[model samples]
Target: MKHIRMILINGPKRVGKTTNANLVADMIGRSLPDGCRAHRINMADRLKTLTNSIYNVRTPDGQIAPPDYLEAIKDQPLEIFGGASFRQALIYVSEVVIKPRHGKTVFGKWFLDTVNQVCKPGDVVITADTGFASEIVPIINQVGGDNALLVRIHGMDASFDGDSRSYVHWKHVLTFKDDTNAPFRIGDASVRPDVLARGGFREIDVTNELGFPERSAQAVLDYAARANWLVRPTEVDLELAKGPTL
Candidate 1:
């Protein structure tokens, strides 16, 4: 049977998850056999599309506005679209509208379907936007425990500090209030805590104090190797296998 390696990189926003994921993907691509490839997919791809549509903005080529454009206009008033700032509007649509109607795992299911349809055998698929347990659990179930790895990046400026009012929670759409001790809940369940409690997948906690430099990438690669997701030939083994120079 053909096997696909799926790596889900989970962490607070702006903490170099995407950088690390790309690094891991490049490493895996270099190590893969001929005809195999590595791909990086974002879980928020569809959400971003929906948000663009809500904003009713399009590129000159008629495509939806890209993320950079969206980021630039995130603070624009949505009075015509009937909301607050574009950023808050996206949060409202995602948390209060779509998720409540379609279920929390809707995006995860869509992502899994995309992977099954587009990914080939021996492909290494990585996503750096994982946040909720509702999303990760279903994807892990589809990929199987042995084939999936959940990497949690830590030590960044926005790292979660167990405070409901922390910037990490705010980035994830959690509301901030005077009582910072309250649990960070997105609906009924606590956000980060729920994700941490999920099992059935191999996990590596990467301390990315220096962002995704050579050292941090190597740290992630080492953890992946220990998790059995990567099998790299040692230098001594390669040297011994080499025949004497003719």
Candidate 2:
């Protein structure tokens, strides 16, 4: 239970998640106390190296199993290699077979370890958000409990549903909406609206309110700062935002 003030900037793709994250980090560094540090957990950079290995049994014709085709040759048998040989191969693949892991090489526990290092007692940690907001909520709990706070900057998109989208959604979600009795659950964990409000967590509907064009990162950050979060800029940051020097 270290006291950490964490802000999770989440939303759909092209929603300015990164821009807001960076701005928030910069603001925290300037606005907070002298010793406070504003750090960004760039998940994309870290997770781009994830291992995505597949155990494929190339057929005699050179046609491999379709990627992500997970119909096990169990229960009712199908064609192809068939019988005992297929069963043995499947067992070997399941047990001793080693395949390349796709996506980020390190996940779950490893991610938490990295985050813990970036965080301090009074620092503001802005997670470089991914589409996996719901899925990673548990990881946040594991890393920062009463000490950390989660804020999701929402974007309007019909395709942002957890199931349909590539960004896998988890059952346990702690959401911030204008809902009464809306206790969002993350895995087995849950957070109520009142709790979030008390903990300095709130939501902003950027799609309608903010006149953000498609995929503009900077616009998203501006919207968040104006609406809910305050991003205090440093001299360097302000210069960067204004554009590079000649």
Count of backbone collisions within predicted model 2: 15
Task: Pull out the clashing pairs in model 1.
Answer: none
Lowest-sum lDDT 10-residue window in model 1: 163-172
Local distance difference test scores for all models: 0.61, 0.43
User: What lDDT score is found at residue 149 in candidate 2?
Assistant: 39
For residue 6, model 2's alpha carbon misses the true position, in angstroms, by 1.5
lDDT tens digits by residue: candidate 2, 1-246: 145555555565445555556655654566566776777775433222221123344545665544223223422343433543343344343223311221111233344566677777666567745444433444544533344434444554534532222433322245512122223311323344444444433333344224432223344445444543333423235434423211
Query: Candidate 1: what lDDT?
Result: 0.61
Which structure among the candidates has the greatest lDDT? 1
Regions of candidate 1 where Cα sits further than 4 Å from its true position: 71-86, 160-200, 231-246
Error of 1 at 102 (Å): 1.1
Give the best candidate by TM-score: 1
Q: Write the per-residue lDDT of candidate 1 for residues 1-246, one digit (tens) a residue.
A: 127878877776556766677666676666666888889888877777788787776888998777446655556666745756666666677777677666665677778777888789888898877776666545544556567776777766765443111212222322212222223322222233443344344666677765234345566666667765555712122223222311
